[model samples]
Target: MNGMLPWAISFALIAVALAMIFAAIRLLRGPAAEDRVLALDTLYVNGMILVLTLGIQFGSRFYFDIALLIALFGFVGSAAMAKFLLRGEVIEP
Candidate 1:
């Protein structure tokens, strides 16, 4: 019903999308494994942000759930990758 909120959301969505794109480029072109992992983590965070913003715009619980899942998996994945980079193993036997 208001014009300003829609514009604000649109701007946020575009900004998040651009962040995701930059993260993706970093993931692809990073010189170090840690840099790539950081980029990947950034991508996930940006993705989660985009999802939440979209949820706010659309008033959808589904988007929130998806964003939560992304956050969980992204954290787990970053931890695993960090472990692997440090010790060459995600799960030590």
Candidate 2:
């Protein structure tokens, strides 16, 4: 079971990477700003998943912290971008 952990994480990371590539293509080819933003959000989610897989592969808690930070930043950035796209500004005052 212990030996299988790394292999499982490796497979998950590979899957996430592939998904990220597809998301990148979507980001590049999206016809609308909102579509591009949605693709970018998906990319962020894949990145967080990759980080988690890395943490599992390496048996490190540090990567978990980094993943948490990435998730937090991703959420905040996506929200700001969406707000800016909808209202033309992130903040009114």
Candidate 3:
């Protein structure tokens, strides 16, 4: 089982990369603003997952930290974009 671990991790990383590619295509070609926003949100989530998977594969604490930062910034960015879409501005006076 141990011998299969690296292959599994490689497969997972490739799958996530493919997913990210699809998400990027959607982000670029979305028909509407909402669709694009959703795609962007998905892209960030996949990025975080990819980073976490790398951390697990490599046994690196640094990748985990980077993944955490990705999640945090992604959430905040999504929230701000949503607010801007709804109100035309992210911050309220």
Candidate 4:
């Protein structure tokens, strides 16, 4: 298990990077605002996963903290965008 850890991490990083790239393409080529928003959300999620995988590879707590921040901000941003799409406003007036 230990011997395969590095290979696993490398694979995860590559997979997440590919996912991020695909999400970016969708964000740019999406025909609708909702598709763009969903792509953006996917990009952030992949980013967070990439960071967590790096944390595992390096055995650093700092990466975990950064991943947590990414998850928190990504969730909030996605929620705000969804709310705005549904009601035309992120905050109630």
Number of the top-ranking candidate, with lDDT as the measure? 1
Compared with the true structure, the alpha-carbon lDDT of candidate 4 equals: 0.93
Worst 10 residues of 3 by lDDT: 1-10
Which regions in candidate 4 have their CA more than 4 angstroms from the true location? none
lDDT of 3: 0.92
Residue-pair clashes per candidate = 0, 0, 0, 0
Question: For model 2, how does the per-residue alpha-carbon lDDT over 1-93 read when each residue is reduced to its tens digit?
Answer: 468867777789889999999999999999999999999999999999999888877889999999999999999999999999999999989
**Per-model lDDT:** 0.95, 0.93, 0.92, 0.93
Residues 1-93, candidate 1, lDDT per residue (tens digit)?
669999999999999999999999999999999999999999999999999999999998999889989999999999999999999988998
Candidate 2: segments with Cα more than 4 A from true spot: none
Name the 10 consecutive residues with the lowest summed lDDT in model 2.
1-10
Query: What are the candidates' C-alpha RMSDs?
Result: 0.9, 1.4, 1.2, 1.5
Q: Where does candidate 4 clash, by residue pair?
A: none
Candidate 1, position 13, lDDT: 98
Candidate 1 lDDT at 83 equals 94
Backbone clash pairs for candidate 2 read none
Q: TM-score: which is higher, 1 or 2?
A: 1
Ranking 2 against 4 by TM-score, winner = 4
